[model samples]
Target: MTWVVLTGRQNHLDQAATPHKVITNRDYLAHPALFRGQRPKVINLSNSYAYQSRGYYASLLASSRGHRVIPTVETMIDLSERKLYEHALPELELALNKCRKDLGGSFPAKAHVFFGIGPSKAWDRFAKLLFDWFRAPALEVSILDSGEWASIRKIGFCPLGRMSEEDKKRFLDAMDVYTAREWRDSKARTPARYTFATLVDPHEELPPSEIASLRHWARIAEKMGVEVEPITKKDLARLANYDALFIRETTTISNHTYRFARRAQQEGMPVIDDPLSMIRCTNKVYLNELMTANKVPVPPTVMIAGPADFELAAETLGFPLVLKIPDSSFSRGVKKCSTFAELKTLASEWMEESDLLIAQKFIPTDYDWRIGVLGGQPLFAIHYLMAKKHWQIVHHKASGKPDQGGIKTFTLKETPPHVVETAVKAARCIGDGLYGVDLKETKDGIFVIEVNDNPNLDHGCEDTGEKDEVWVRLTQWFLDRLERQGR
Candidate 1:
């Protein structure tokens, strides 16, 4: 991508030693030459980004033209309103309080951030975090130190001309470091047509996709001219740099994965397991109600809120029922009760953690069918057998380890059409993202258990049926969307 710097005046452009092109905002807005070629990464350094100002329009138009720009129009509007940015204060304040003594100066401290670089090394991490949240090229922040902790008082964009001589030198140096890359050179730009971010947590005990599987997907994508980069929670600030996002980690509404999905949608980037899917899939209570209202075939289930509802659930769903926490995953936070006393005890205890719980009639099947659906079609199918002699697919041990059941993979054609169709129906209710719909086949009928947003696609497991074809389809899903967006 090309780099262009837009400033308010010609003299302001003269101050920078950047190798990239620099022009006045007027020239960028009106010059036909600037508008004709490939869209560049715009560094909007105009004097003021106030609403409807020249600087504001520069960033706004850059976005509309498919150019990557710093301090996006969303960022500009966020800085304009305290209510818009206040939600980010708690996290930023926590970072500030961690290094309070290192802040040095006085009660009120002012810090300048130039492209995620702070005025001093001590403030670099905090500055990077602030930049990740706001995504502005330059920021001026005021921190007020209380007796117990420090709080953010104000945060706003810093114009290029308002800086002191020393700050200007630091700013220029930071800019040089930020842009001094081989890719920054037009002749040496990256060959890949698009960039993709795969979010993963190396430390997660049970990641949805194994590192090898992720590598396989990346290799396939790279061969097709898409660059795949693995990112973690710390890379949230760099999310906008990617053309698409694939969340390989387990998703929850309370975690960074949801934040990443939300940010990706806001930036108009294609993302798997979108925020709405995460919200709808992670909570069993929501899924239960959604499936019931849609007339989806699910085992008889009851939503238990308080102890008063336990008797009703037991009468309706029966004694040997499964109790589930709303946001549970990986067979955790699920309980099986055999009698009325056990049901009351378990439901009462689980109710403390969540306001609502799912009580479903126990369907004793040797194995549960896991139908993997992608874009409203069956991608793969598996028989998740019970763990040893246990009734659940995974049994938690007293030693704090889990004993998982064996899996039998089958192709789409080999699986029962009704099973695949029901899974697809359940998945579409969540959205067209990838899903793993668990179902149980009994004497009566096949019943939908739950849908997982972040289903396991581990190598040597779910890929056993289609092998490399699965990865190809997954990659194509992203590429097809990118092509539609004219990427």
Candidate 2:
């Protein structure tokens, strides 16, 4: 289902144009079926800055359900809060100081600053809020809040809105030019097929097989009438132009990849590594809690805050424990502490980054069963062997050298039913996105090590026997999801 919410004054302005469900901020939360079923696309048209406004919750609800909502309630909230203005403050201060220097480092009584969302009514609203402050004669500040400044980072000053040029030329011309460039780029770029932009780190060259997997996807997309293009950090502003996003790069909270996922999701596009999925799969602490709560079998795990939690960890988990920083990839930050001294020393260092850490029992397995799951079903399975003489698939040593492992893929029908069942169960604890659930075949039973959001899909490894099928199924899922959204 699709929804277009306009401001109270502009209700039904374009209802005759599109068949999408039209709503106001008042009706967004009141409707029961608003967020359910056919992946509704809600375009909230209310000012998100007002703390209790309906537009604010509209973005939040839409995002929580993984729907495409605009003005990104998240982005709006970030803009309004001072914390999100970290970058903007510096620029604003520089401009203000420069202006004040001409005025003897002080402002006259009539000096008033204007911050806006757009060039019109929002500017008026923001101007009213600053009336209590001293205003200087012939000094008015204006900022605009239009769709042009779309990024949460670049748009740090976004929630303030935009001012009209008639208010007087200010220091925001550079920002406006930046937004103009983005606008033109988005408008000029058009996709002939169902566009699927894959986000990748362009600088880091991927393996041949991994690159081939993309070719496999490109081939499948061609047959399915979809276009697949590789995108990096530079193409983030144009994410909204695509129909779907298939990310093939490692994801982190502090990187542009996560922003791409967020942008795709907010634009109502079907994106893998959806922001929520990234959050859930990235952190081991969250995964451990989620798996245990759902009754999925995970290795005995403990959450350590500091040295105080170490003695109980030693008693409950015993020696030779596996230490993990909350979020890590490629087996980095994961250590095997065979002794208490090592655990203390390592925990101290890791704790500097995060207060909490994950300590799981050392379940020795020659190889870990990596089950590729998508849309809550098993797509493919692989036996990921540990690096030679190492306890994990990836061994990053103190010298910064790394040793990698081997992977043997198995067709869906060739895999064990138990492994598939266990993997699906574990991955479900996170979400129905594409995931790699790592499992161990131990003496007692199959224990889930952890779930990876971006599992290795190296061309010859995970896609070996079922290469075509894997790529085809992955691409088909997008078509199916798009169809569902339209329903």
Q: Quick one: best lDDT, which candidate?
A: 1
Tens-place lDDT per residue, model 1, 1-487, is 3578899998885734777889988888876466454656688999999999999998888877777788788899999977999999999888767655675634347888888888677776688788888888789998777668778889999988998888888888877765543212233334556667889899998789988788777667666666677888877887897788999898998989999999999888899989999999999988988998998899898888888888998899886899999999989998899999998888878878799988899899999999988888788888999999899998998998899999998988889999988899999899988899999988898899999999999878998887888888888888888789886
**What does candidate 2's lDDT look like per residue over 1-487, in tens digits?**
1334434334322454334555666666666566554344454545343566776776677666655555565556645655654654444434434444344444332233322222333233333222211111111343332322211122222221233444334423322321221111222233223557777764553321255567666756666666676666756644653679988888887898788888788767898989999999899999999999998899998899989998878888988999999898888789999999999999999899999999989888889999999989988889989999998988877787778888777888999899899999988878878999999987799998889888777656787867777878888889898878762
lDDT of 1 at 429: 92
Alpha carbon lDDT of residue 389, candidate 1? 84
What overall lDDT, based on C-alpha atoms, would model 1 receive against the true structure?
A: 0.84
Against the reference, the lDDT scores of all candidates come to 0.84, 0.66
TM-score of each: 0.80, 0.63
